[model samples]
Target: MIRDLEDEILGCTRCSRLIDYIRKVAIEKKPKYRNYQYWGKPLPGFGDPNAWLLIVGLAPAAHGGNRTGRVFTGDMSGERVYRALYEIGLSSSPKSESRYDLVELKGVYLTNAVKCAPPKNKPNKEEIGSCSYFLKKEIESLPKLKVILTLGRIAFDTTTNILGIDGKFSHMAIYSTNRLTVVASYHPSQQNFVSGRLTWGNWISIFYKIKTLYTSHNA
Candidate 1:
């Protein structure tokens, strides 16, 4: 049933603007990927169905996830995340080059606030709201979900709204109750990493904290 829902997410075109934008990008292939085929549709969340940890990102990178057909795949941000998860014993690989890269998660699930890649990496409020329904269904499908790690303020805010939690956003900010823990972390965008807003040390520290808290919660 969960798999069926994921397929439904992949086919969703509820947001016409998003659909048009994605199609435009698909046609205007990047020079390096001129010969490659793009997925060009809504990306369904990836990882273990019985996951305890849910990592919510802002959205698909126009060229990365949009091209590779996998959330957090074939991108710098993905490199940072998979490496961190690998170090923490949650990921099978430190690199997510493509959807067929054999990358796997042990107890982790990865997804985005918005399923489709929006123009300039920004989705308006209505687009976000339209996509939230899919997110809500995905969250509810994970019966074992105990922790949600939201990357960036957009992801944090969207997740909180879906879960009906009025929580503030800040790096390392944590909201605990309702049988789940929601932790906010800075997004690993190139800008954030290049500007040192989200450093390797800090990113790793957040995952370590998650491991500790999750262990204690489920112990």
Candidate 2:
């Protein structure tokens, strides 16, 4: 079931604008990544299949996930994510630089609101609505999912809308759906990290809270 959904997600071409943008970015190549061959396609969510926790982000970064072929890989946001997970004993590595890396998530699944990278790091309402179908399917496929951690306001809003819930996004806020506990946090974007909006201490603490929530639920 999961594999089928993943295949469909990978081959998705629902958004013409996004597909064209990723391909264009891939070919043009950033000065820093000129020699690198970008993945330049839709990304699939991945991690422990049996996870009770699901972490959601906005979408793939143009040069990050879109290039590396793994969500949150090859970016500053990814660095904080994997480092926090590793410190919490949920990931095998403190960093995820490539899709080939030995990074393994123990009890979490990671995905995004949109599977493909969008221009200016923002996907419009129509695109987000269309992509949420795949995201919803993923949530249904995770039998053990009891908690969802949404990074940033966009991610938080998308997830809640998918689950048919109504809640405003707030950093470190917690909400509950009929079948899942939802937590929202500030995205670990470069600005958030550099501007002191999302500190390392708070970032790590979010994971710790998730760790505690799932542990208690399982207990």
Candidate 2, 1-219: lDDT as tens digits: 666888999899999999999999999989999999899999999898888889999999999999999888989998888898889888999898888888899888899999999999999999999999998998999988999999999889988988888899999889887689999999999999899998898889998898888877778
Off by over 4 Å in 1: none
lDDT of 1 by residue, 32-115 (tens): 999878889999989999999999998898888999999899789988999999999999888888887788899999999999
Candidate 1 colliding pairs: none
| Candidate 2 TM-score, true structure as reference | 0.97
lDDT of each: 0.91, 0.91
